[model samples]
Target: MSMLNIPLFFQDTAAVEGDMGMLWMLLSGILVFFMQAGFTLVESGMTRAKNAVNIAMKNFLDICVGSITFWLVGYSLMYGDTSNGWFFWGGFMQGEGADLFFQTMFAATAATIVSGAIAGRTKYTTYIIFSLLMTAVIYPISGGWQWQGDGWLTKLGFIDFAGSSIVHSVGGWAALVAAFMVGPRIGKYVDGKVLPIPGHNQILATLGVFILWLGWFGFNGGSQLAWGGDDATGASTVVLITNLAAAAGGLGALITTWIWYGKPNLAQSLNGALAGLVSITAGCGNMTATGALLAGLIGGVIVVFSIEFIEKKLKIDDAIGAVSVHGVCGAWGTLVIGLWGVDGDTGIGLFNGGGAAQLGSQAIGVLAYAVWAIVLSAIVLGILKATLGLRVTEEEEIKGLDISEHGSIAYPGKRQREFEE
Candidate 1:
């Protein structure tokens, strides 16, 4: 019997369920879509005046290119039904309309994370290619293993309430690999000493951070997939814990940085807020407010120390600290799910009651993502580096991307007077 020839009674229930799923997915998609603006403002404010336009333009183009690529190939690869253990295929044609919309936003997010890492130095053309490849290939394959129904990770009992590993960690790993491949921005390191590259405007960056924090409510909250009744209680709890974690993250970063650095740095505090949000993403629905608070606080402290360690010890130059904020803290958040999620009914920590099973599962998930992301990113970046040349020439580097690549200055005629003075 043809699908269209099926009896009305049989078809009606399926149709209703499909519509509800689409609605939930659409709401979540809208929330994730707004993150682009948050990223643009945050990245632009964190860099030098000479490169602000370039930074903003890269973010804009990432959304554009990323959306197209994901629609064309990413969505199917990521969530398409398949049977393979290590790899899956979604064919060329699958997922239409709303399903496409939700997955496209996720693809864009993975692409945008790289923008912050290579902010000042990368060529726009190269960045565009990277974005296209990430959405079209890298992110989809990894996400497929976790989000797709038939995915091995899902079968293994891995639970990522939002996207601590799927989205944030993937981006973070790509950024870490790219930063090492691209090398430090000019004058960032001199005579084996790390030179500070102060953000052009902390206030603007702070505003951008706040925008991201606001959007995260929709991010974590929307992931609940429902908002009413006892059936939707999980969604409500997720929202509450997400908010508490964010607040705790801010406080934790503020206190820790104040003690360590002798003052409450606004930038660090802002990062602390983001750190908390990222850390709680994996377990927002599974944890309590208290667990969220502790998780966020630890995430904040981890980001500060991770940032310092990467710069000082590893010599990896991440322009906006994307590596530490997303990569390190994202891993921590995923692990916390094992330690803090409610075991059966009572909310408690692993130290209090939760067993080692969840913790081991969390560790396995983290290790798997780390290995997959780093190896895949290295392969993708290496190919791009060999084929098109990843970094700009020394002449172009000194001239600034706005003028060299786009043939316009971000500040126009102001440069002449500023230089003369």
Candidate 2:
């Protein structure tokens, strides 16, 4: 039969479906792409003005280098064809051009997250090496288990709707390890007490947070992979829940910080917004709006305590609160499914009637990512520390990396002049 003989209903419906799906994916991609700018500003704003150029440069370079690495090897390892499900080295080494594009963006995101943690003191060369290794090796391997079609984790029924475990947690663990190995920023700790290292520009930092929140729509929405059919409905729900969570997160953080510090802290509130976003990432599509709000609120509250505990007690120097915002919140988001997934054929929430099965899965996934990312990041940073050296010299650290590494200042010709008393 001639192709023109085909029924118009089927052909038109298929074309419409394809077009809608493509539109959704493209929009989502644009959203995720914008996050790079958000990251750049956030890192620059949080660090000292003296090293602003260096911080921005590291973020820029990571996207470039990380993108290339993922294209060449990372995507294949993570999502390429697999036979036995788990372990190392998947058979699908080369990704289709379309899939590669999406995967590359995610890989770059993981690489950039580390820049904030190791800002100010690390050598530029060392930073590049770490970024390349993380995207090309560590992140891809871990991502395979959850997102890969034939990976053991996926087969084992593990779920991460967005990337709480795959993306944020991986970055968090790496950041934690890097900060420990690189040691605290100069004078960040003195007399056995942690000192506050206030960000240089709160306005810039807040602007960056807003950008990140805007970009998250794409981050969670795209994960739905819906273009038509029932998937489109699910995608819309994801977007709704994501926004609700972010709103709840901001409010939760604002209230808690106001109470704890006896004032409304802009920085903590901003962090709360991010915490809510991260907490809902893993289960946005699965949970209801109310579930998302509660998850975000709890995530905001948890981040406040986690940040203080890690910095004050553990003595870890996380310059911009990456560990708490990404790591702790990411874990909470992933596990929230067990506590709040809608009941029925899908599953039951803990509050409703669910047991520990799903929660246990979340814990295992968390443990797997935490151990792998921390151990590998430590090894990579430790090797760099011993060989080419991870940190700039004490003089450079004190003087700032913009001049020491880049030979240019972020705000040129603004040097402060000192007069003898």
Candidate topping lDDT: 2
Question: Candidate 1, after superposition: displacement of residue 132 in Å?
Answer: 0.8
What is the Å distance of residue 196 in model 1 from its true position?
0.7
lDDT of each: 0.80, 0.82
My TM-score estimates for the predictions, one after another, are: 0.89, 0.92
Candidate 2 lDDT over residue span 1-421, tens digit each: 6546887665777665655665676677778878888988888888788778888898788778977788677876786554423332334333234355666777888888888977888899999999999999999999989898777778766778889989999998899998888889988999998998777888898899889999898888877765443542367778888999998999999999999999988888888999999999998867877789999999989988888998999998989888888888988988888787753245556665677777777788888999999999999998899999988998888778887898877776675311000
For each predicted model, how many residue pairs clash, with residues at least 3 apart or on different chains?
A: 0, 4
Instruction: List where candidate 1 sits over 4 angstroms from the true fold.
Output: 1-24, 82-96, 229-233, 343-349, 416-421
RMSD of each: 4.9, 3.9
Output the worst ten-in-a-row residue range by lDDT, candidate 1: 84-93
Model 1, C-alpha of 27: deviation from truth (Å)? 3.2
lDDT score for residue 107 of model 2: 84
Cα lDDT, model 1, residue 58: 87
- Model 2, global lDDT: 0.82
Tens-digit lDDT string for candidate 1 (1-421): 8756897677777565556655766776787788888888788778776677788888889889888777667776786653322232333333245556777787788788888888778878778888888888888888888777678888877778788888889889889999999889888999999998777778888888887887787677766654432422356677788888888888888998899999998878888999999999988877767878999999988988998999999999999889888888989999898887764365444665767777887788888888888998898789889989789877776767666677666677575333111
